[model samples]
Target: MDAPVRFDTKVALVVRADLAVWQKLNVAAFLATGIAAAAPDALGEAYVDGAGRRYGRMLGQPMLIFTADRDQLRAVRDAALERGLTLVPYVAAMFTTGHDAANRAAFQAEDPDTPDLVGLALRGPKKAVDKTVKGLALHG
Candidate 1:
């Protein structure tokens, strides 16, 4: 037999019961739990080829899915859907570009502004020269 107490501390105790259980979780586990806890209001936006294709911003339990090509995009989307997650396609380039706006913009225009050779390789070096003759015209 148990007696019901009319006290505000009852609710606090009930909520805090799981506190110790959660405190032992690692950083990755904590982050995953936090995401799951906040999934009710999280959003998933897709950027396709530098354009916003689909805006599933209101969807709950949102997750970002990105790829470099159409085939890879299809595979990623299917895998996500199979895992009970929403499928949204976002271009990897655009997502990465968000980190460095200036360099991305310059690269998009075929102009190499960043000192990163890899970035130049990814975006290509065609835009740096107006014409093939001018581009091929070597400077000594």
Candidate 2:
């Protein structure tokens, strides 16, 4: 059988560190979902060890975290778009009260005004990802 394909790239989830703990967690989860949807191969597979314990490895894929404010987030979004890079953006409605309500809000909230970007997940060539996120500091 042929081996499973693996991506030789880097994944980064840049988020606003100033958000509340819950918001941060929500952003991270949404961002990861974006990466998984875009690059499933990068996630690798689940395997069992000799002791019969199962382990889930992130495939050793590099996932760098960075912090940015509202303006910085917008800049990153623009940069990603300009570079033709895939961007998974988390919007304001994602922090809404309920799942159904959030989805409704998000659908209604989509407009030309460009909803605020709370978080972003970008994946591509290592050099490309690095360049796109240049000048951004690592999440503290």
Candidate 3:
């Protein structure tokens, strides 16, 4: 079997039946960055080359993944979860509330679980990813 061409992680492919969930939701994508300057030894050169791209690719969108070790995942998740409270809402508030506005509808319907799922969605299909970068820049 091949290592699947996952949008962000292995979990996403299973959760998404078609690509519609990803298309409809505004996701905040996050990847697991290995230890940073705070722990230079752990976040050494190897970690930088591999994990940095993974981390940077998903950070601005609406999802999170544990691509690295447990420690790195915990640190990233803790910081991100804290940041997410403010960050997620701010991103959601960007959409205009109108009948034709699917984005707004999704945003309005967000619960904690959905928002996290949305974050994953944002990290999806190449086009959605392009939009996520643009959206984050617009709001950030």
Candidates in order, TM-scores: namely 0.20, 0.81, 0.21
lDDT of 3: 0.29
lDDT of 3 by residue, 1-140 (tens): 98744343111110111224433333222212211211233222322364455322222222322122223323323444443311222123334444336655655676543342323211224443332333121211
The worst-scoring run of ten residues by lDDT in candidate 1 lies at 8-17
Error of 3 at 97 (Å): 13
Query: In angstroms, how far off is 68's CA in candidate 2?
Result: 0.1
TM-score of 3: 0.21
Candidate 1: stretches off by over 4 Å: 1-40, 43-65, 89-140
Give the worst 10-residue stretch by lDDT in candidate 3: 9-18
Which candidate leads in lDDT? 2
| Candidate 2 per-residue C-alpha lDDT over 1-140 given as tens digits, one digit per residue, 9 for 90 to 100 | 99874556778889986899888878888788778878777666788899999987563475778998888887888888878777888877667646756765784676635667779889877778788899999987
Question: Against the true structure, what is every candidate's RMSD?
Answer: 24.2, 4.5, 15.2
After superposition of all CA atoms, the RMSD between model 3 and the true structure is 15.2
